[model samples]
Structures are given as structure tokens and as C-alpha cells.
Target: MKILTIQQIIKNIENEVVFEAYAEDESFKIKIDEYIPYVCAAIHDGGQMRDDVLEKCSLSTYERWYEEDPHTAEFVGNFPILIQGCDSRFEYDLNRDPDNAIYEEAWGKNVWETPLSESQKQRSLAKHHAFYEVVEALIQKLESKFKKCVVYDIHSYNWKRWDRPVPVFNIGAELVDHQKFGDYVESWRDGLSLIELGDIHNYTAVNDVFYGRGYLLGFITNKFKDTLVLATEVSKIYCDELTGESFPEVINQIKEGFKTAILNHAFEFIKNETSYKVSKQVNILHNELESDLIKIDKQLYSLVKDFELLSVINPINLEFEKKKFLASNYKYEPQFKYNPLNIDPFEFKRKLSNIKVEKINDISIQNMYVDTINAYFDKVDLLANLGTNKFLYNSLRYFGEPSKKDVDNANFVLYCPEFRMEKEGEFNENEVVELFKNATQDYGFQFDIEVSDHIASKALVINSKKKVVIKKGVKFDKRFTKGLIEHEIGVHMVTTMNALKQPLKIFSIGLPVNTLTQEGLAILSEYYSDSINHDRLRELGLRVLAVNMLTSGKSFNETFLTLMEEYKMAPENAFYLTTRVYRGGGFTKDALYLKGLKTILNYIDQGKKLDNLLIGKTSVEYVDTIDELVDRKMINSPQYFTKIFKKHLEKPEINPILQYIFNGIKD
Candidate 1:
């Protein structure tokens, strides 16, 4: 490949820049080589206005920037043979016909305060003429080497101004001979539609937002009979148009993703192109199965919600010693006596395994969908066995305990004790209700809260159902309100609302492996709200140690003694910690808070986007998989976002003291 200078880059361009031949101009950066059979050009990317026009133009630099293609260069960056204009379109728009190159009025407003003199007009037209001269040379070079050549004329549009969801990409073919290349064009759109940028889906269409009627496409098609130009218009969904800043990741994703797909389609076109189709029924079936899964979630969680607290707290005011002994001796059995499993896991698994994955666009992805659903059903079976020895055995099978790394990470908690001044105050339930109502309004979330005797915890949170049942007679502390809202509503309820925006029910309920991520995100939300206090951290630390003891087969008395004596926790608080782990057949779920906090904090430090975590019960483990679903438009972005943690900021360094407190396990 060679880079050439514009003066030196006439029709028969040649350059002697070492590794190859080339003359170069900033206005035109073309990577040309031995008959590559195609060229990718972005003609509207320039925004430099000539000094002469500076006095004559009425628009501001930003105004012209708003109309310019900011990242078209990134989209076509990787092509071996490329041609892109570098001058501002305000100087001359190569895509427009020669006479219209310098706009008299652009879009709707007057572009210039005064019309350009003949010399200035000729100057702009001369550059336009020079661009086509090289384009024709490049085309001729390709046509002589191969029988035909194809051009991908790339540009972007402002889609947000439109009233509806438009295609992420639009291929304009008005100027192309669709009679010969229509199938190839549609195939290209289909493949582009499958391209993804993180969790954002790529929706592509043909002749939708723009028909390929640009002068560049017309000139090439009319002059070169065998040459085809696909006028591709991608919406600036890949960037914040208002800010004039582009997402490099998205730019890279498309630049790399489409490079090969475009080449593959072209090669196929060169060899009798065929068409591909996607099944509409598979999407319907996915929706139907999701409905079935939603029913299973209600049954599973309702029974297990307060099982840990209720079963462990003896109603009778027993002696302190007796309570301590009973805490360890707490025995549980199958709970089908009250809450029966509505959907049998075994049958549910059978149904999911029977799905015809081959019908989906990507079979492996479809299989993952099945596996994730089956995982939820597995949890349902485990929930059915809650309070029994059977539940403990099954809990091990589904939700495993924190590993050594998880324990080790918990010790590094952030030490901002002085920052927790709000913890000193107290408030009543009415205050709590008002506070929650105010917090919800920040994100525009809708829900109801009430005080109730049937509730166990001070705040019995049922976020997925948008309900927070406050235990009657318990005075609510004002300090707990914000953090609790951040935890329960910001993280949990916000995700529930976000899930509703998605097409699948799994997001609405939970991803089966969601326990760790869900709790972790909840705790993280508390921290983001600045409501995290040492007391809350200590409570989480105690739960971690308690769960570790249970998983290691320590009796409740052993765990209780460790919390009370070694950790110096009060007797009542120690009992609460013991039961939290030993309930639900040795539930190891509580350990996740510290584990989740550390993991999520590390993820942010490593520069990962956290929005993926908010998309309806998504686990950090399945982010890539969930992203693929989101890219397919099978899921939607979070509709409800947390104001507390609007976006992840730079993470503070891990606190070794806090880390030691949580992740430490004495052998």
C-alpha cells in the first residue's frame, strides 16, 4: 500500500515514501494497492472552512460540526484500500453534485453571509474535481485488474431527531443497479444487522432513512458500468451527536466487524450470491417461554423470602443460653406443606432442553439461552427444598459459597467512617415512606410502600413486585432510608423496571446466577448513595464469616460464638447473623454482599461499563452473552437508571483494612 500527495496523486498517482509508493494530502488519505477490487470512501467527514469563507460564512464552527460526519473515518479505518476526504464539507461536499459542493443554504439556514466570488467557487470545485480524478484512477486501476469493483460509500445521520426507532444502519441503493445487486445489498444489511456494539443492538435496513441518490454513487455507477456503490448511512447512535464526541469502542466494533462481513458478501457476490433468511417463529417461542418462567419466579422467591429470619428466631422468649443452643440446633424440613413448587424443575428442564436451537440465527447463542433458563429452573427446585437438609444439598448444587478470593477481597473495604454522619439520626415509618417516595421520584420510578405486621425485617423488600413492606411497630431510622432505597429500589426495583423494557422475562425476574451480582450491585448502590457506614460494612462482614462457617459445616452455635466473642458482636446481633446463614438450608447467599462489592469495584477499576449489570437481573458472568442478546434487539437498555450511581466513576483504591475485615477467614 502507498500514501500519495494530492499534487503528486493525479490520475496516474505515484509516491516514493519507502515501504511503497505515494504522494499524500491531508484532504485525501487513500490506502491504494494492487487492484484490491473495492474502495471505501467517506466524503462528508471534512469540516474545515477556507479562510476566505470564514468572513463570508454565517454559521459557527460547532454548527458546521453538527452537520459534519465526525467518525466516518473510524468506520472505514481498517480497509486495505481506502479513500476519505479530509477537508471540511463546508469547503466542498464531495457527495453533492459539483455545482452544489459549496452550499448556498444548508439543511434550512443560510450557510454563508455572502455568496462566494467566482474564484472561491472555482477553488472549491477544483478540489472536488481533484477527488473524482483520483477516484476514477483508483476505479480504473481496479477494473483493469479485476472485471468489476464495489464501493462502500459510508456516512451517518442524526437519528434522535426522528420520532421513532430507526435502523441502526441504512443502505441507500437508489443509484445502484438493484436488478443485479439487490440480493447482495439485502444480504449485506442482514449481516450488518447482526453486528453489535456492547449491549446495543444493530438494526439495519435498506432504502429506509436514505436512498442512495448521492452524486458520488451516481457518478461512479454511471461512469463505470460494472462498478457498484452501496451508499451506507449509519445513525450516530454510536456517539453523542450533541457532544461531538464518538464512542471509540463502538467505532472499533463496527470498523472491524463490517470490514470482513462486507468483504465476505462481496466475494459471494463475485460468485453467484445467494440470500439468507431468519425465522420469525423462534422469537415468538422465546417470548412464550419467558412468560412461563415469570410464573416460576413468583413461586420460588415468595416461599424463600423470609424463611431464614422466621425459622431461626424462636417466638418464645427463651433463656439466653437456651436461645444460643437452639440457634445451632435449628432443624428444618421440606416446606411444600405451605409453599409448593408450581413448576417442577425436572419438567421445566425437559421443556427448555427441547427447544429447537437450530432455528435461531446463532445456534450456540440459542443454546446459551436454554442453559440460562434451565439454570433458573434449577434454582426453583432448590427453593422448593428450602428449610430441609435437601435444600442444603441442593443449594450447594446451584449457589456455591464465596471462594478464597472473595473472602480475601472483602477485607479491603473503604474506610470513610467520618463520611457516615447521617447514621446518627432516626426517623419514623411515615418519614421512611416519604423518603422512599422522594428517592423514587428522582428516577421517575412508580411503586407503593406500607407498614405491615406480617413483614419480618424492618423493611421487607419485594423489589421485583415494586413493593416494600415495612414491619409494623418498628421505628424507621432516617439514615437507613436513602441507602435502603438505593439498595432495594435503585438497584433491585430499577432493574425490575429496566427488565420490563426488555423483550424477555428473565431480565424482569432474575438471571439464575444473579444472587451474587444482584446483591453486590445493591450494596454498591448503597455506597454510591453515600449511605454506606461502618455499621453496614460490619454487618456484611459478619454475614460473610457466618456463611463461611456454615459452608465449612460449623454449627450455628460455633458461628454465633465467633460473631459474639471474636468479632465482639452483641448477642442479639450475633443471633441474627447466625440465622441468616443457617436458614434456607445453610443459605450461602449473604456472603455475596462483600464478595460482590469487591468484584464490582475491581471491574470498574479495570474500565468496564457497569450499565450491563443493570439490564434486568444480568450477572457479571453473563455480560458478554447478555450483550449479544441486547445487540440482537432481544433485550432493551435500562429504562430506569439510578441517580445515586448514574454512572460508575473512578473507583477508590481497595482499602486493605476493610478488605482484611471481610475477606479474612481464620484457619
Candidate 2:
């Protein structure tokens, strides 16, 4: 940030140069990331008073802070253009007109024991004049460049002082040209109502607590006909109004929610003004934080690749052990030896914790990046504990254990007569590889196919390496081959390819708990392709049951016996299922397949779009943020989509029994 004189600031605006600076006198600050059509101003967000002025004032420091709009600038700091005052409003309120700028009394109390001298009054008024001069120059430049402008005049009020219940947000718009921009005013008010600040339910109304009577609004509205100033105020719910202690978590939530609401509101304003045709040149602003995020993402990717759980957890001598366990009459547990760890788990977790997410100007992006980093922390911890007794605890921390509802739902599906159908296949592992190769060709992407004896599943995709591994001797039913291809190549591989093309590498690496959404989407693909059957649905339910049993402290032999005797599963199939849950000391991720499917089903039932969800390894919860990023052109749409999803889009279909089963499951 640079310090520049008023004339230099005006010259930079006139030249359309982007910069961040403070006025030479240090009365205010301005940051221009890009000269967009909107501006954010926090005129009363300061409590700094000159020594001379402070000496004459009768009010204490707490009194001054009570009247000032603290942290108001931070609420809209993510915007492209921002200007905020740094001097105490008690000296000369920036929101008041110049004629009455210096206050003699405030909030029905005397402001000074001795009135300020003529020289002191002139000094305070000079800062006020300089602030409006810069504001005029800014609006002039925006109107000249974009033909219209919107200003978010941010402030905060003391809600506790009111005798009656008041709204969380109050928009003062009485002084604006409502006849011309009445819809925009109402839209802004409605947008504020969407902000979620922890336990505080947001309530917004126009001209409820205070009208738009500030000098800043009057000055801008009178000077620029094309400009609309929205006087947005938030009650002091984010802090202890009486004690002045702030709740950081609540403040963070407010900042995150406010960023999305204001940006969406601004985009709508511009779309309406430009007749719904936004120019490509109007790009989202980027900063140094992008590079910082990329560095952290790369570090996380490297750590994850070194700790692929399947490669480390699957036993090398599986066939020999299976024969021995069967020969011992299923009394002796299988002795499993795992592959060596490439990196120490403790050291890996330390590295993950060391990588910090810096404070980003864009609150929405910052929140996403922060969440991704925290998710990585849990992932590294889980990976470090692989093959140990502690692994189950870490797995529970990362991938939560199935609830009683999940177990009941799984048992329901297992017992349902409609899901008892079974079928046989003639295709071998080699034939499955050939099918995958052809499927990749049709999808316009290439992935290496190799049959390996180490993996436990029939086939799985190592998305980061762009490779598919098939179990060496497994057989796949010919009817299920197409659905398997759609599951791996169509959904997982497509999202991987799309994530690799993103500017931020975190998408390619995957988000926290992305496994749940990714697996759910894959199953949905199979259903849409008409390859899903009752047998497949039952298998998903059994996996959920297996996970629940393992989490409930059932031993490998106990779980295997229950599956073979009680569930009527084949001996060999029961062993495989038990091994899947008991591997790496009680893995519990299998339960997510059923839960995730239900989540996706409910998401689609709400009439939400899938294009955003398919953009990368993102979850259903982040669809709105992805859509916002697409609107801002920060990221592009997915290059490859599930053929089944596209077909479903044209003509949607779902199995009646599948819908009934999921609809019966409780949230």
C-alpha cells in the first residue's frame, strides 16, 4: 500500500490505474483492485482522534467507540473498490454535511468541555473536504467507464439501545431516487436478509431505524444521477455492545456471508443496467493470495500422493492367507502385512498443520481455502494412523461412523425382497480392461489401464495419476461393465480432468469429505445409464452394514461369520467384505456410498443443477459458491461431463424401488 496526496490519487483514478493507498494526511484509505461499477465506503468506521481534539472532548474512549462503526470497513473489504475513514467521527463526522460536520453535542450529551479552536476546526474540516474530493473523482471515473455505478455505504448501529426489538440489518434509502431504482433498493434489502451470522437470524428492512439522511449519501446522489447509494447498516450483534469484546467466529461468518450477498447483488445490478449482457472484460479481481493458495495446494497434493491408503493397507499375501484362514476353520484371524510408509505420519501431519491460509481480501474465496486446508489436516492424521489401533479413532474423526439410522436403513435394503436379484458375468479382468480403454476413447480422454494383484476391489481409479487399476483375477458382469465405466471414467475421471484445468490446484486434489459426494455422483451415473440393478443396490447396503459392524467393535472373524451365516453371503464374498472394513485397522469409508447416494438424490429432488457440482471434486454444499465463481469468470465449466447425466438431463428417469428406499431413509 502506498501513501499518496489527494492530487496524485485523483490523477491515478483519471488514468484508470489500479492501486491501494492512504491519503498523505492519513485521514482515510482507498484500494482499487479494479475500477468496477461498484464502490464500498465506510465513513464512520474509525475512532482515531487528534490529541488536541481528545483533550477538549468530555467523552471517554469507550464512549467514542460506542458511537463509531467499528469493523464496518472489514464487512465489505473484499469488494473491488473500497474507501474508509480513519479519523474519529467525534472530531468531524464524515457522514455529516460540512456546515455541521464538527459536533458540539452527540447522542443528547455534551461533546466537549471546551470548544475546539478556530484552527482545530479548520484542520478537521479539511480532511472531510479531501475525502469527498476523492469520492467525486472515483464516481466520475466509474460513470465515464461503465455508464452507471452503485455504492454500498456500510455502517453499524447500537441495537441494544432500542427499547423495542429491531432488525439485524437496516437499509437507510430515504434520500435516494427510489422512483428510478426502487427495485434495486428492495433487491439490496432482500439480499442482506440471506446473511447467516451464527445464532443471529438476519432480519433486514428499509428505513426502519434510520433513513438515508447522511451527507455522504446526499453528496453522491445529488452529484451523480447514474449512481445509486445503498446505506446498509448492521446491528452490533457481532460483538458485546456493552463490553466492546468481539466474537471472532461470528465476525468471520458475517464477513463470509456478506461477501456472497453483496457480490450477487452487484452482479444483478450490472446485469440489469447492461440489459443482461455482461462484458467478458469485467473480470473478477485476483491478488497475491492466489499464489499463496496454490503453494499450499501443491504441498498438500504431494503429501496425499505419498500416503495412498489402499496401496499401504492391502495385504501382499492375500491368496496364501485366505487359504490358511479357511483351513483353520475360520477361528484364526488373517495375519496381514502392509506396504511400508514412505513418510512418517507424525511428520506429515506437522507439515500439513504448518501450511497456513493467509488472510484473503475476498472473504468467500478465503473461507473456501481455509476450509480446504483444515480438511487436509484431518486427512493427513487419518493417513498417518493407517494400520494401527489409532486408525479407527482417526477415521471416525475424518469419516464419521454410520449412525443408527444408517444401520437401520442398510438392514431395510438388505431384507427388501425387491433387491434380492443376482446375475453372473462372463467377462474377465482382461476384458474389463478392454472395455475401459474403449470407454475412455469415447469420452475424449486417455487413462492408463493395468491389471494388478494388490488391490481388493474389482477396479478403482487413481485420479491424480490418470490411471485405472483392475484386480488381476476379478470377473465383471457384462451388464454391469457399462455402469462401471460411467462410474470411473465418466464421473471420477471427468471431474479429475476438469479439476486439473482449474487455476487453483485444491480442486484437483479434492475438497474435504469429497469422497462422499464423488461416490454418490458415480452411483447416480450408474442409475441414469440403466446399468444399476437390485444386486448392486444390495451390495451398497451390505457395505454400509459391514462398516457399522466394524465400528461397533466386531472382530474380523465375527463380522465374517455374521455375513456368511446370518446374511447368507458366500464364504469367499464374506471374507472380502470383512477384509474391506477391517483393513488398515478398521476403515469406515464404505458407509458413505449409501449415505452419499441419498444426499445426491435429495439434492436433485430440490431442482438444483448438476453442472456446477460436476465442475470439479466439489460437494453439493458448495454449488452456490461454484456458480458464483463461474458468473465472475474465475473458473470455467467442466470440459467433460457424464454421458449418463447428459442423457438424464434430456430425459430424466429413476428406478421406483431405488427412490422408495432412499425416500424412506431419515435425514
Candidate 3:
């Protein structure tokens, strides 16, 4: 959190232009943390080479040359040392691309002139290659631990050509993957407040301006595509034009902006695997359901042609065991075990569609909230009744009065109903829904309100047409509605709509085993300002706390009691809410908060592009088993909603802490 300091950052840069430390602070530690031994090694090598080059002239002559405006001398002095331990040839030329003997803009000089000077050539190869070789080795080592790696080949460029005018910052002129590098570079632009001067200095790779083909880029790209090489070329504005004098102000600014950019990308790159893993897992699960319903069962037809599913042919028992293991683990987690009702895993496993059911309560809220529960159940039943073979829904009838177990298993339950007397007149339930629709169009989502006379508890469900069923008299507070909209419409409905658009209804029916990312994505939708409010943030925070509690093995009763007695939540409210946190015993609510936060933050960091999170464009671990199917085109993109939500997604800048967490590789 401390402001930028010099030593911490300069020590990390291959060439500092000048070696002077100014101001010590925490930001320095963060910057220094990103400097692996590479900076030291590169500088050390460059130093040694400088001495060797200077050996040709006398000490007096060298000192006098240096005295004539020492910044260039300082740079030359540090250069050899920086690259000391590297292979001056086979590895990286530092000044030129490794594959070429001459720079791309060497003014047509035959830079590789000494055909007979094998010794000189070998020395160049040995010295230059050593630096790049060490770089390559370091990259490989880093890649083993991370999903990607980055190489910041630091250098300074004179903006004013002898024959031309000076330009602004020269971002490695061209051949760079703009899509992959744009975000990070943009971060630099923001951090530095640099003005755009058109594309004057933005030459593509190997153009007339300072082109070097066989440099670090060649070595880096050849071995690893994931390894990003940034050849930063700072202008000579910091040096005296006539005498090449040094200016501390310019140096400080470049160091600050440079450090920010590197640290930012480094953090994201390191955490990339975890996020991608979770996303991929979700994708796999999504694709699998589509495949099972459309390809195997042949009950649903594809609405989109490219939708494909990747199937894993594990033995049936193994699949069952895996599912059971997850369920058991979920149930045993501290937050999940707080429920009082019994969950029948048998009933859950017996039903093969993507839906899961848990018995939430025993106090006869079943018949008590029949009006609400019945409508939800019947709507799901209607879908099943409609000849959809791939998607299935199971119900967990509450066996006991609300308990920790019950709350954990069910999404939400209606407290004993508080009847709201219509201001004056009574209307039919269907008519009421139409009225509500007209009233809330300014909001979003169309609700299919069904007042159930037979039900005591209020529950919610979404049908294929995207109509939501809520028991009448359920308190329509901001929390309930926001959570409902985010979970149902954003995730379930959108995914369903996309699936339906697929040439096959199987994808439309539902996705299997996609709980993690599905739930993560669903919960993330609640954070948007358009949908979320103070009440929603509170609910989400509690959910996160619940996940932490459940994973620590808190029982359902304990969790319920804790929420009510300790957190001072209302008894009925606490009991009902605790059930959700404690369900699946542990795994149920555990995912909604932390995992959801991570997913949402990542989406923002990636610029709020929902295409990846929604259209299944994510990694296997972070997603479901269905990714393979989507990859294979077994599942198709949703035509109606994908584009609509795409613009709303915004990738936010990576936070420094998370970036610090991911600094391992970039360092």
C-alpha cells in the first residue's frame, strides 16, 4: 500500500539507466518481490561485458568518455553485468533477436560481417546466448508452476532519430498479439496517464524503427506461446539531448508505470490456473448434459449445429461414487450439517437429470406451503410432463420442522405465511402474475405468480419458458428477489435459452454436473448494480461466511443456533437461512460465496465479457464436464441473450493484492 519507491523496482529491472535508490516503502517490497534473480543476473552480465569492452581503452580514456555525460556510460556499464551469466548468442542477443545476426533496422549494414572471425562470432554467441539461455531455463521452471509466464526485456530507446523528430512511448513495435497483450498494456497507459500520439512509434515487429528480429522475442515465442515477452523501449526524454544527462523525474515515472503493469499481469497469470480449472470443470459438466440428452438419449434435437459434448466413459459405479463422495463431503461440511431435515441421497441419485433435491424441513411446511411449493413442483413436473427426457427434477419432501439440515438442502423456504390483504379487491393468481409483469417491466424477468392455498412454505422455481413461480405471501424483499433473479434468470434461464437455441433441445433441457460454475456464475449476477443493492451485499457476505463456517465442519443445528443466537438473526429467519448454508451438508452453500466472488471478480478483470463465463468459453477445472461437448460443438451459443449480456460485462483492473499473490511467475 505504500507509494512507489526506487530500489525495490530498479533492482528488478534488467537495466535501471542509473543506480540510485530513493525512498523506502511497502510498495518497494511488492515491486522487489517481482524481481527474480534475472534482473541481477542480466545486470551482472552486462556489467562484466562493459568492463571487457572498456578494456580496449585505457582507464583515463574510458573515465573521460564516461565523464562527457555519464548516463549512457552508466547504461553501458550496467549492460554487460545484467547479461553476465547468459549465453550471449544462442540464448538472446539482448540488443538483437537470437535468430538474426543483425538488427532489423541496422541501416542495411552487414552486422554479421566477420565470416572469418570465428572467435568473435563464438564469443558473441557465447555471451549473448548465455543470457537468453538462462531466461529460457527460468521460463520453463516458472511455467511448470503456473499456467503462463512473462519476460520483461527492459531497454531504453532514443525517441528522436538523428534524422527524425521524437515520438512518445514506443510499445514493442508490432508482431505482438494485441488481443492477449492489449489489456495489460492498457493498464500501463492508465497507470502512466500517457497520451496517444497515433501509431507513430507503434511499428510492427521488424519495422524500420529499432527492429530486432532474433532477440528475446524469438527465443521466447519459439518455446512457449503462453510466455509473453514485453520488450519495453523507453524514450530518451530522461537523458540530456546534447550531453545525454540523466533526469530522475522521468526515470521514476517509467519505473512506477512499468512496475504496475508487470505486477498486475503477474498476479492474474498465477491465479489463472485455479480460476481456469474451476471454469473448465463447469464447462465439462455443461457439455456432458447436452450430449447425454441430445446425442445419447435422442430425446432432444439440436437447435444449434456446433454444439458438441465430450463424454467420459467412466464405469457407472465410479460415477455414482464420485457423486456420492461430493454429496457426502458437501453434507459433512460445517455449514451444511446445520440442517435438521434428512436428505435422501437415494432419491437424488435415482433421478438422472441435472436437478438435485434435498429434504429441507419436517414441520409439515410441505402441506402448509403447498400453494407455493406445489406450483414450483408442478411447473417442473410440467416440463417433465412435456416429453423432455434429458432434464430431470427431484423433490425432497420436508420430513421434520425446519432445522439446519433442511435449510442447507433447500434454496429458500417461506416462513409461516404473513397474509397480505389486497388493498381492496381480490384477483385470480394468473391475473395477478400479469399485473406484476406490467408493474416490474422496468426491472426485468417475467414472473408467473401462482398463489398456492395448499402450501405453507414459499419456494421458487423457473420453467423452460423462463417463468418464475413463487408462493403467494412470500416476503418479496430485495434479498429474495435479487438472489432469485441472479440465480434463476441469469444462470439457469440464460444457459437454458442458449441450449434451446442449440439445434438440440438436450442442451436446452439442462446441463449435468455444472453446479460449481453454474452456481458461481448465477451468484455473480447478483453483484451488478442494476440487480444488486445493500440487502444483496449483506446476503452475499453472509453466504460467504456460511461457506467458511460449513467447510470448517459446523453442524446444521450449530450453524442455525450460531446464526440466531450469536449473529443475532431472527429465529425463523436464521433457521431458514441456515438450512441453505448447511445443505449438501457442506458443499451446498460453500460454493455460492467464495467461488462466486472469484468468478465474478475474474469476469470483471477480464472486462465483464460474459461470453467466456456464459457461453462455456472457460477452462475445464473452473467449469463442468460439459466443456468437451461445447468444444466439440455439441452445445451451441444462445442467440437471443449471449449478445445482450456481452456488452454489460466489464473486465476490471486486477487488484494489487491478488496481483501480488500471482507474482511468482512474472517475478
Candidate 4:
């Protein structure tokens, strides 16, 4: 924030320049981010009292604080246009006219031991006058640019003073033209009531605590008939009224809740009044921060280059050890060796935290970036602890362990009569490579298909390199190849290509819980392509049960025996599933495949589109935000959608047993 004279501030407003500054006299502060049609004002938020006035005042600092609204300015600080007073209302109330701006007695208590001099009164009144001048200029600029405007006049009141219970939010609308703006007021009221403040039951009312008779509201309403001023007030539930101590957590919740509510209300107001949609354009600040974040994100991405958990966790002598374990009558646990971590987790997390998300102007976008970064931090921690006992703990944090419901779901699948079915195919690794190569041609993108002995899975899509690696000597079932194409190329590769086309690199990197959504979508693709069989479903369930055993402190041999004997899985299949869960000291990611499939099934059952999820490697949690960005043209829609989704739309029927299994999974 810079210091500038009131004249300079008004000049910037007139020129429609985006700037944030305090008045040269330090009386008030103003910020113009985009010159939007909405303005937020905290006229009574200031607590600074002049030295001369404090010397003559009979009240203590606590007494003055009791009468002032604290943190009111912060509630709407994320807005594009904001004006807040710096001086206490006791010096001169910005909410009142100049005649009675300075109080003789405040809240029924004496204000001064001696009367204030004429000069002192004039000095304080000058600040009051200057505040209105800037407000007038701001409103004038907005009204001229957009034809009409709305001002959110924010304030707070003491709820303890009333004998009856007061609402959490109060809107003063007595002096406004209700016939024209009553709907907007009611809409604002309804939005505020939806805010969740921890355990606090939130309620909002109009004209219940205070009437909209302040001078600021009257001045703006009388001067600009097209501009509506809402005297928005909050009860003192965020702080103690008598003690003056604040609950920072409660204050933070209010700020976050109000941020979304105010933005939505203003958007609706502007659309109704002017038929203009507020375009979400990235300003220079956003661009600069995004550039900085991408650099750090790319560096973090580099640390895990060959660190695909599946490849890294498998012992180099996996084949030799499996034979030995069988020769030893399955008594010895397979001692798995993992690749050493080449990067420092702490150092990388330090770099990741350097990108200050708070600097981003939009609160919702800021939160998205924050969550994305935190997820990356957890990933780094999980990678650094590979092969160590700590790896399991970190794995649990990143990919949570299965719940009892998941175990029950898996048991239900294991007990099904169709679990023992199997199929054989004639296609080898080379044939599958040719099939994958042919699949990529339709998407008009170049992707590599390599038969490698190093990979653990039959075929894995390495999205970072735009390549698919096939485990050497593995046989692919003819019935599974088509669904494999949909799973790998249609979903994974399509989302990867779509992410690369996005303006922000984070989409390509991914959001938190993307694994759950991505894996689920991939398996759903298999189901949609009609290649999913009872055998494949049984494998998914067995993976979930194996993860449950691993997370429940069961050893590798214990989990392997349970799968082979209790679940009646084949010895070789049980060993493969056990290795996947026990790898990296106890990975829980395999559990998400079944969980993800269930989540996607439920999401589709609700009739939501999968196009947004395919836009990048994002989770279901951020679909709404992605949609918002698309509406504002910040990001483009999916360049390539899952082909299987279109095919499913044509023929939406699935096997009844598969539908029944999906229905059995709980939320």
C-alpha cells in the first residue's frame, strides 16, 4: 500500500487505474483492482484515534474498541473495489454527516473530560470529508463505466446488548427504494444465511438490527439513483463483546464464507442490472505468480522422473525371489528392494511454499492453488520415505486406507459365484504394442510404445513423457485390449494432452486426489467399452482387500495367505496383488481403483458430465471451479474427450451383475 493525497487517489479513480493506497493524511485507504460495478466499504472499521483527542477522551482504549467494528474491512478485503477508514469512529464517524460526525457521548457513556476545541473538531471532520470525496469518485467512475453500481457498506454491532437473539447477519434497507432493489436485498440475505461458521448456527435478516439511515448510504443513494447501497452489518459473534479478545479461526471462516457469497451476489446484481458477466481475466499479478509457481512445480516434477512407485518399489530380482518363495513353501516374506530417493523432501517443500497463493486476487483460485501445492508437498514426503517404515505413514496421509465399508464391499465381490471365472488371450507384448500404436493414431498425437522389462504392470501410461510402457513377456487378453485402449489412450492420454493445452501448468501436474478420480475414470472407461469381465472385477476387489490387510498391520505373508486361501485367489495372482500393496513399505493407492470406480459410477448416475474431469488431471472436488474458469474463458474446454463416454451414450446398458456390484458400494 502506498501513501497518496486524496486528490491523487481521485485522479487514479478517474483514469480507471488499478492501485491500492492510503490517503496522504493516513485517514483512509482505497483499492481499485478492476473498477468493477461493486464496491466494499468499512466506514466504521478504523480504531486509530488522534493524540489530541485521546488525551482529552475520558474513555479507555477498550471502551473505544467496544464501540468500533474490528476486522470488518478484512471481511471484504478480497473484493476489486474497497474503501476503509483508518481512524476510529470516535474521532469522527464516516457513517454520519459532518454536523454530528464527532460524538459528544458514545453508547450512553461520557466521551471526554473536557469539551473538544473547535480546531480539533474541524481537523477530524476534514478526514470525514476526504473519505466521502474518494467514495464519490469511485462510485462515479463505476456508474459511468457500467451504467449502475452496488456498494456493500460493511459494519458490525454488539449482539449482547439486545435482550432477544439477533441474527448473524443484518441488512439495513429502510432508506432504499424497495420496489426496485428488494429482490437483490433478499437474494443477498439468502446467500448470507447459507454460510457455515463451524458449530455456529448462521442466520440473516433484513432491517432487524439497524435501519439503512447512515449518511454514506444516503449520500450515494441521493447522488446516484442507479447505484444501490446495502448497509450490511454482522453481529459480534466473531469476537467477545466485553473482553475484546478475538477468535482468529472464526474470523478466518467468516472471511472465506463471505468471499464466495459477496462475489456471487455482486455477479447476480451486475447481470440483472446491466446484463454483463464479470470476465475472469488474469491480471499481471496472477500471471507473475503463476509463472513463479510453474518453475517450482516443474522442479518438483523432475524429482520423481523414474519414480513411478510401481517400478521403484518392486525388487530388481522379483522373478528370482518369487520362485524362491514358492520353493520355501511361502514361509519367508519377500524382501523387496526399492530405488534410493535422489531429492530432499524438506528442500523441495521449502521451494513449493515460496509461491505465495494469498497474492492471487481471487479467493477461490487462491484456495485451489493452495490445495494443489499442499498435495505436491505430501507427494514429495511420500517419495522421500520409500522403503522406510515412515513410508507407510506418509502413504496413509496421501492415499487413505480403506474403511470397513470398503472391506465389506470387497468381501461381497469375493463371495460372488462369478469370482472364479477366467479368460485367455493370444496377444503378446509385441501385439499389444501394435494395438496401442494404432489407438494413438486416431487422436492425431505422437506417443511412444515401448516393451520394457522394467515395468511391473502389463501396460502403464507415463503421462509426463507421452509414452506407454508394456511389461516385457506379458500376455494381453484379446477381450481386454479394446478396453485397455479406452483406459490408457482414451482417458489417461487424452487428459494428458488436454492438460498440456491448458494455460496453467498445474492442471497438467494435477490436483489433490486426482489419482482417485483418474483411476476411477480409467476403470469406468473399461466398463463402458464392454471389456470389463468378472475376472477383472475380482482383481479390483482383491486389490482392495490386500490394501486393507497391509494397512491393518498384516505382514506380506499374512496378506498373501489371506488372498490365496480365504479369498480363493490363484497363488500367482495373490502374490502379484500382495506385492503391489506391500511395495514402497505399504502403498494404499491400489485401494482407490475400486473406490474411484464406485465414485465415478455414482457421479455418472447423477447425470453429471465427464468432459470437465477430462480437461486435465483434476479431482471431482475442483470440477465446479474448473467450470467457473471455463465460463470466464480463463481455461479452454477439453480438446479430446473420452471416446468410450460417447460410445456409452449411444448404448447406455451394462451387465446387470456389474450394476449390482456398483450399487453395493457405499458412499
State TM-scores per candidate.
0.50, 0.84, 0.33, 0.85
Question: Which residue pairs show backbone clashes in model 4?
Answer: none
Error of 4 at 63 (Å): 6.4
Error of 3 at 295 (Å): 3.7
User: Compared with the true structure, what per-residue lDDT tens digits does model 2 show for residues 1-667?
Assistant: 6899999999999999989999998899998977778889998988888899899999999998999999888888877789999999999999999989999999998999998999999999999999999999999998888888899999999999999889898999998898888899998888788887767878889999999899999999999998999998889998999999988787788788777677678888876673334543224343334445567667767666444555667778777778888888899888877776777767776776776654455666667766776776776666677778998888888789998888888888777766525575558988899889998899878789999877777778887678899888877887678789899888988898888777766677777788889998998888777776776777888899899888889999999999889887888778877887888888888899888887888888888877877878897666766776777667878878788899888987877776676677636
Most accurate candidate by lDDT? 2
Instruction: Write model 1 residue lDDT over 381-496, tens digit each, in one string.
Output: 56667557787776666777867765554443423233344546777777777877787777787777777644324565564457766655556555566778788778877786
lDDT of 4 by residue, 405-464 (tens): 888888787666673146755588888888888889988778998887555466788877
- CA RMSD of each candidate after superposition: 22.1, 4.3, 23.0, 4.3
Clashing pairs in 2: none
Using TM-score, rank the candidates from best to worst.
4, 2, 1, 3
- State the lDDT at 175 in candidate 3: 49
lDDT of 1 at 592: 75
Task: Point out the worst 10-residue segment of candidate 1 by lDDT.
Answer: 280-289
Compute the lDDT of residue 640 as modeled in candidate 4.
91
Of the two candidates 2 and 3, the one with more favorable lDDT, higher being better, is 2
**How many clashes would you count in candidate 3?**
148
